[model samples]
Target: MSENQTIYAAFAEKLDAVLSALEMEGTLPPETNRANVSVEPPRDPSHGDLATNAAMVLAKQAKSNPRALAEQIVEHLQRDPAITSAEIAGPGFINLRLAPHSWIEELSAIAARGDDYGKSAMGAGTTVNIEYVSANPTGPMHMGHCRGAVVGDALASLLEHAGHKVTREYYVNDAGGQVDTLARSVHLRYREALGEDIGEIPEGMYPGDYLVPVGKAAADEFGDRYVSEPEAEWLPLFRAFAVERMMEVIKSDLATLGIQHDLFSSEAALQAAKKPEAAEAWLREHDLVYDGVLEQPKGKTIEDWEPVELPLFRSTKFGDDQDRPIKKSDGKWTYFGADLAYHMQKAEKADALIDIWGADHAGTVKRIKAAVAALSEGQGTSIPFDVKLVQMVQLLRGGEPVKMSKRSGNFVTIADMVDEVGKDVVRFTMLTRKPEAQMDFDFAKVIEASKDNPVFYVQYAHARIRSILRKAAAEDLAPSDANLDLLAEDDLTLIKQAAQFPREVEAAARAREPHRIAFYLYDLAAAFHAFWNLGNDDAAKRIIVAQSAELSEARLFLAEQIGQVIRNGLAILGVEAVEEL
Candidate 1:
């Protein structure tokens, strides 16, 4: 495994050096900031290999015309042997073209490092705590958590690849009311398991048949002793039992998607340790909490809305809509208060924090961010925090909506979706679109082996390359000794696309969005597929040349590099790279 930094970063650094030299020579004023200068690939490939806005960004401070400044920067940049040509484009933009050898060397770096070719040290081993799929242990993880799980898992993998010390955590909401309801529901099933007809489960109670096994397990463990037991006696024991069993089911479901968190922090455990109360006291000392009376909500208000003096957090100080209550009128901690405590605990050990939540929790992001800011400030440390609100996925089959689960009355499960298409398809399709966008996962379209399906398309690119490489090796023409210089222009284009993997990975990790990698893989795969078809139209563009063993090896080398990129990308996505379709 190696972080052979991409040529892009290398060029950017070289350009920065050039700017520094110009600064020393007084071509630009002393101590002139070059921070805004950017070196990146041009929008049109025909324009150049790399483009820079150095002159445009710095011309004003230097008191020179943009074009003249660009020319001066170009003079210094062209001296770098790898940069074949640099030209001034509209107004002040500089376009650059690198020697084909630069790309060829980059391909060699990729082939040498294999799957770890694009790994980066962007995070520098910072401890990043990502809380995701903290679903209620009340039942099996369903479609609601499916996207968040995949997204979180991919983000964790991305972070690790970028050299972050990542903690994949699931904040179990065991202390919440939903778990108590689950306990009652399981007790009802326990009676049924003991030969009592409990009839229809009551409204507001989880009525899934999935709880039947929990009930039966309880019955088998400790028979009718609980049958005549009081609610107080059985509630706690059943809640514990049901939560454990449901977590088992949830873990099994996550395994089907190849997801396993490193930690499972329980709210009950946090509360038992007095973290919430401690946080409240800490906030009070910091003057972030106050006793306030709130007005009734507009229009249809909360049923129990009443004027009362309760503990409230100054959430509006951090962009929240209004000051939020930290304690209810009954003198109990609000959910927000407990959540703040949980975040405070997380903040103690983390340099950065991320939470993946369902879209319905969108309104809660601001207050939590505010709480984190307050907590970090009190501790005299800056702990960054962000929340990703994943939108709902509309399940479709043959263009018709597939709504509930047959076996359980709750939502369709992650297990069912994984079982239907496949783990790779499930994970990949969940990320084909941005998390904030509502996407329809159509069963028929996703399973189709066509360009329209990104997973299949990307996987097919790798599979096809593998197939060709195997055939080439059968003829004893390996790519190792081939002169990569013999590759066609389009092959170099494909190589350039592959070389961008490191930059893409770094950007994706920095942005905390793994979907960018998914999108990149799809584009690279499309490029590879298009290059393969070029051989169909023109025999000269084919990988295996009849008379030239050297050229055949060169093409094979290109294919190997492309395949490596696809595999590396899929690895970050937590999806398998199939060798054959």
Candidate 2:
């Protein structure tokens, strides 16, 4: 827990004690529970710093008017030294106005904590596996994958910062029919590299020019050897060559977006291993594996749905809609079977798993969780697996949707998007919205030099601080806080906002929403900008002046604090915070 957490917890304990004392003395009615009481910042500033709903929540059982109960609660709380005053407001809301010294003390605590200010043990060293950017190696990532990549990376960073042992992983699905198609496509490219005509691409094959180079290398390596070979003879070789090139391109593309994974698990390697068989063996030992025929799924009819008995997994035993197939009638494991093994690996390696998947896989959520639960056999019982579906990103340019049809060979790659907007703007805009909500990224709007461009607005705030620091250094003023209390109302408003940085980080981390950090930084930057503009109107409000070097140092100290918060926030999101525009 953090200092803020410690303080709030102590306050809650004291409040609980007060309620217990009242209950024991029979000053309150019976059966009034106090467990749900909470202290949080009020929505309205005039209501005071923190507000509690204790009286309102407990009023019915106490058989007293909420305001009366609030008054009784306030009389007891006002005796505490930490609380300056407690007022019973409308609707029995108990509003607290802490001593100004308390705010100063919080600021001091922040200064003492420094970079560790918002660190928390909320996760308690639990392991969380975050799988993201498992984009098919068919082609380079597009704008849609970019948003998920940034969101996942930022979320992992936030989780780690909040005390979870996080593993950033990328799943490579190289065993699917898509790889077979890629192999054939590369063959055509190899023929083309041999100066063959190789007309239009066949249907159901990759048409992108990206595979041309891979084909050329393959042809150079084994000129006429595979020219007359059968499909089976060349398919595996072609797949290996194509996937290696695809992974290389993917690594470069991810580098452009500043994303690096801790692990890149290959589906083919896992399938080829005896692991899934071992997993099946484990399930068999638990009596969860059997032979059965699955009824055809509704909503879609498979033309080849012949009722044939096959090895099945008792997924419905855990809570799936029905029993699922582990192997097809052809004696090959189905895609879902491979997924079961992957999840089993996750369950064995980590205490918790978080899969960042595309919205298209939303229906797979229940079955995946069910498989993990069934496989664990109630030992690692409540398998806390969460799936985050990152909605699509509509890319726009000049107020019009950018046309990107892959069939036309004009799809936007992540590299192109990052190059157009630059990495900082790309990272910031991608995080400006929650993963659950679809986002719109207007290329024109993001590059604009206005408030609508959150990236520029926030970066400008940091740049302005650097500018002020430059001015301070040129004027030979110290940056330390010799007399930070000299801050005026406007100055202290900015300082107080900065003081909320640690709390904001903790909240954003716990909520698993890094976008909250982005939004908070924008709000903080707006506050600093308003303060900076005020100084432009009145010169005495300037950050640096000729007299009272100690006061100047104090204001500079506040500016440095604001800059540090912005820097840390941007760093978590993997955006660069440059000192100059």
Note the clash tally of each candidate: 0, 0
lDDT of 2 by residue, 41-145 (tens): 778877777788999988887888899888888989999887888998888999987665556555555566666666667778999999999988888787768
What candidate 2 gets wrong by more than 4 Å, as runs, is: 1-35, 54-73, 80-82, 287-289, 296-305, 316-319, 405-408, 545-548
Per-residue lDDT for 394-470 in model 1, tens only?
98998999979976786899889988899999999998999999999998999998999998999999999999998
TM-score: model 2 vs. ground truth: 0.90
Give the alpha-carbon lDDT of every model: 0.90, 0.82
Badly placed stretches (over 4 Å) of model 1 are: 1-3, 300-305
Candidate 1 matches the true fold with a TM-score of 0.97
Candidate 2 lDDT at 103 equals 62
